[model samples]
Target: MRILMATAAVTALTLAACSPAANDQKSGEPAPPNPTQTVAAPAEKPVYRFKIGALDAIALFDGQNPVPNDNKVFGVGLTPQAVAAPLTAAGQPADPIMLEIHPLLVRNGDRTMLFDAGLGAGKGQLMQSLQTAGVDPANITDVMISHGHPDHVGGLVADGAPAFPNAAIRMSEAEWASIRANPEMADLVRVITPKVQAFRPDEEVAPGVEAQDTAGHTPGHVAYLITDGQNQLLYTGDLMHHWVLSVEHPDWTVGYDDDATAGKKARLDEITALRASGAHIYAYHFPFPGLGKIQTREGRATFISEAQPAA
Candidate 1:
């Protein structure tokens, strides 16, 4: 599903998209009145990095692009304004919403697994981000996908070829079937199917990694759980997108959900389970390097931004 907002309009209008003021403050950091003074020796922009026991996880920002905020993209009933209103109120661009597509790479022992390829070959910088993190695409042993959306699966093939030539591409059977059947995604499916390895729900295809069938967002939507003895972390692939929005109102369906009702149910259940388990979550669409925990407050679940602490 797609929601439209005009985030890039200011840039198109040439009204100072990124000024000294914008760049100096840094994201998740306080904005200085005149940040240009700090520009001389700027701090490195934060990169998402963490660990779950012995498993090391890194959030590689493949960069993001804006999609038109049309009514139908978000599914059937939701309007663009309805979704944009909250994000705008929260200080995010209201007209054209930017979707930050992050592809995660998890390293366990010698196994380097990349979760969701991101907007690969066509027009993203996932490779650069990976390199910045000291990871090579060829070093990725496994490429696990949560779904078949263009952004999620697009990175599988580059320039009409498999990006990770040495990696085994894995995804849900339902996702492969849906992508294959859709005329729009048929070409991508055809190209990636040769390398595509399908798996079912509740199955542990990888060592301590278990595939949990979340569904609803798309027919075969799934989440992966990584556990090391007692501690665990969950990679919720687009299961929950907007922070605060999804947590505050877990039932509010996004236009992207193929089955809104099913999405709502799965989200509620997953949030509950995640909270109870106290498992850290890596959300593909939560925010850049979307890493955080779900907290229960006021009888409702809330997404507390934990990647960077408040000053």
Candidate 2:
């Protein structure tokens, strides 16, 4: 039995080494080369890069992951066909949905705020993106989370310690509640709580940064609204998971949504409000550094990539 277990572990390790997403980085350099296999390119280099007035916003790439074949990412009511057809029409995969995580970094004056910490060191390639943009993780003053999902929070602790030792980690108070209440995540929650500074909804988390309660994806899912004196940018957390499905069908719930109904409602409401406000939405899971705007036509929402503005 011991020999069998050891052999199985070795096989798993070997498979991991040969995975397509394997690290291609050389010694002491930034991330692996920017993947040439991108579905679409942003307006500029470093994935999604933009300037919000004086605030410099860059979407740090965290690589892409495949949504499993039978995953119920689009709620219980909708079939995969309903989700894939539109993406296919728009030049995306018809199956095996690929999701890109863009952990955004906002530099405003002296304050450096990171929207979601990238999958640190191991799971994803955010650090490379950051390095490409000339950002040092140690300089991040604030680490603001949209929620506590592994992709968003996995970078919090790498090698069993706070990844950002110098930064103050911020999270919604209610989000902490849901995470801490779960028995499976209790230890992680307990370990993280000491470093966390919980903020109430609709409060100013940082200078020119306001936290909006965009619940439903999680009990305490919050979006950050960053405004310079003139320009504004809104970072929508996981309210929407996929660009095509979430925007086109805001009614669909994500597989990870704690309350599918509430998630759908929240997604629609937030998208509608942002569209009306005419603020650029920086989505966490829409696409890399998901910088896009929401367009409503005949009562249906569509994602308009920032690089490809609507006519």
Candidate 3:
């Protein structure tokens, strides 16, 4: 449990939205060729849907990754046993913890916007999630990137081409620079460079979507604040990952943070801001369709998922 192990761990986070997603699979294994296995994915159930004034907001389910309760990713400065105690108390599995990756789709007038594309089309479930939501990639006029992490950017391109051909890839200038400078992400940069539209951290890339600089997790890490009339929802992108470990003990940093101290502070600040705003939040790495509100129970903030029945 090293307190600051950002350098090596940050490298692993580069190609992942969450480390578990990238670490879980063997690259060479192909999908089984059975006919039924290849059966076309249908327009499945809506992940989670609600409204933001005139805007139609939907949480698209990309996928989930379960990782062991190791001190590497989460709880960067504590033993696994220390982390497991919280899980066991919460009645959650104490061994492997689950992390979900879900993209958000918002419809404002003729403009269709997506907040961070998930792990590409075939590689993850972003496409199926989109299909189920009745949205076509071409209809997405804006792809608002929270940061340049692999999982968020992966679905931006597919098969060596821009996944959302008609969409403008928007991100903070600092974030774009970080991605562009990475030699390992050369291919990805090449594909999206032309479509990339770098803006200031707090710029309003779209009408109701204002990018709030929640830096720390990444240089230009941001959370989207979508406001329409009185309705609002915050798209929290990796500001915190685990629903419990993160919200309960945000002081416990994640190794993936490029700046661990700042990341922890960002979590505290976000929790305070969210509580003050009283706006719904979409946590990218919480449970699927992570739409929820923060409820301060007993003294600490806890997530109350509106998408889940028992919350």
Candidate 4:
């Protein structure tokens, strides 16, 4: 049943590690660049903006972070051929899987909010992207975290101090507990501990921002459903890393999940909910600027990037 509608990796070293870039002219003008093709960049340095109901949104392009597919990171229980099949179908190389790193930024009234800080200072182009977006680190009022992974929380600190000086660092209490005990995150914990405003799952931390539990990828994994009276958008943290393997094939187990069984169930359930509500999404690792909708066509639910030209 073809329901006509337009819209939208975890690889080896993925969960352990996470840029999205183009020289940029001005996006959202004449159809977005193909997620697969490398087109001539517009003058802007990879910053994209759009509206989510009434709030303004931006996709800060950090730069490419690719993870290897040859490793047992993606198709955990399946054969290598099973993993390669989707990439082959998508005409993408099966190894050294390509993914992007871009954190989402949105405005909630007068407050400036960032979702999932990018890789740390000097590690990725997060700072440059912020500059292109005309956002000053000091003015960020809130920093909402999806999880505590390095790639997601890397930019939270720099040189043993908080990076977003004025922002309230928010994350699930479970996630804060998960990382605080990990000795490997000792340095990071020391810096962010005082600033983290741990919230209960499903709690509304801010005006119009509700944390939806989607644990399994990590103990405190979550997605944000933000609405501004007229519309809503889901900021999918690390819920699904790869579009084909994770989004299209939600049943496939991912190596990054702390609990693969629960992770798979959450992935399927989230996809179903997205399809049912038809809300727009701000994907953490779908494609660059990962804005799109989930549509089931030919029995397969896919991420349809917003304003993408005919494929």
* Model 2 Cα lDDT, one tens digit per residue, 1-311: 11221233223333322333332224454321111122233323445567888778877777666775354765456677767676665556656776677888888888888888867677877777777888888898899999988889888876777777778889999998888888877656756777789999898889999999988889999998899988888888888777777777777657788888888899888877866765778878765556756755334465655542212
Give the per-residue lDDT of model 4 (tens digit) for 84-179: 887776555567666667898899878899998989888878888888778999999999999988899999998889999989999998999999
Ordering by TM-score: 4, 3, 2, 1
TM-score for predicted model 2 compared with the true structure = 0.80
Model 1 lDDT per residue over 73-147, tens place: 332366777767655544455445555677888887778999898887657678877877888788888999999
- How many backbone clashes can be found in candidate 1? 12
Better of 3 and 4 by TM-score: 4
Counting clashing residue pairs in each candidate, in order, gives 12, 0, 1, 13
**Local distance difference test, each candidate:** 0.68, 0.70, 0.74, 0.75
What is the model-wide C-alpha lDDT for candidate 2?
0.70
State which candidate has the highest TM-score.
Answer: 4
State candidate 3's TM-score.
0.83
- Candidate 1 vs candidate 4: which has greater lDDT? 4
